[model samples]
Target: MLKLFSLSSSLSILFLASAHAESQVQLSHVPSQSQVEDFNEPRGASKGVEARPILVIASELIKYFEGWYPSAYDDPAAYCTIGYGHLIALQACASIDLGEFARPLSKGAGAALLEKDTRTARIAVQRYVKVDLSDEQFSALASFTFNVGKEKFADSTLLELVNDGDFDAAANQFGRWIKAKGKVLPGLKDRRACEAALFRGNLQSGKNSTFDRSDCAGLGVASGAGPVIDIFVGE
Candidate 1:
């Protein structure tokens, strides 16, 4: 359900006057898979603080928990056990946030953020506002990364499908995940469903690339705004 509107048409007069001064720009700073994994888990804590170790907790759950964990709320142990789960969530959040190189962390906005380099993550999120997507789609993409590492999303058919604008096929492919390494797992199947919903623009569904609010204030709406501003302002 991609909506077609012409904000540009409405603003054609403004655009024409601005078009001459505007210059096109391309983004080439692709994020690497290894870069995201480096932040996949929490690292050392203060020497004497004795803080909860989030990475250890999440890693343990992933290793020991058998088939279909079904989120923290569904697990009776998760409800009965407060402290350990909280610690795990903290670690998961931290690792996830760091995975995007410390960009904004929304509950279900993980997938899109993961493939971005740190410098571009913030800009991407802001630019995401202009894209048409459903809330579910938006949140699903975010949460997908929250579960599966961002690396998977980057190297996934999901990204290709999204960039290609094949929403329905992408949705169909979401349920295809059934294996962990070589073994088919039910948990991964469910997770893929969630991620697919995100990919198909089901969650947070809306139009994309509609808004071009400058990354900075007082800047004209144009490509290369950042670089242009930097050249003039010397950031």
Candidate 2:
């Protein structure tokens, strides 16, 4: 069940500074069927690498894998995350001031945050990727960059091979990122595999049967203070 907490009056002082900076989208209703249909339609890749955006299906993939907490929760890496895995701070949710945050957020509000986060991921891919890509390939890389963080993605052998236009080798690099909090998490392995498959145009899942793995089941642990994800690493 979705957990909710009433905002205590004492938190007003804490809320003053951040309330203006946080997501203000109050979703009162779900997207219409037509809206979903439009989003699902292929936005098509740009001729240049700098302008490409992930397809709608790619964003949905990120959303499905990320934790759905209308109320903030401590993520594996110890970040205070809320609304489809959007990380904020390490502080308790109550101590963080989110203006108008009514505790449990609606699915629509959560999705809005996801959409916003994906844009940053998309920009990272566009900025570093030099080769032209199919919609699926760009989407796959965008998802990878989103989870792994832009700094790591930028320095990754995966990015090196991708910019070199050696896609097959790049596809294998996803498996290398299967550890989090300095331990191997089983969940990260499958996530990497699916992402690899998606880059190879063979991705399929229960939440989605669409166009994708590097199954890193036997991968060794890597050291990290954060989640298997590195989004906060260089930020």
Q: Each model's TM-score?
A: 0.34, 0.65
Error of 1 at 213 (Å): 38
| Residue range 100-182, candidate 1, lDDT tens digits | 22333342332222222222222222233334445445444443333433545555554456557666654554454334334
Pick by TM-score: which candidate is best? 2
Clashes of each: 27, 8
| lDDT value for model 1 | 0.33
In candidate 2 the C-alpha lDDT for residue 210 amounts to: 33
Residue 234's lDDT within candidate 2 is 22
Query: What tens-digit string does per-residue lDDT give for candidate 2 at 81-157?
Result: 67777665544555777655547888898888777656656777888899898887899888887776666778777
lDDT scores in order:
0.33, 0.61
Poorest stretch of ten by lDDT in candidate 1: 24-33
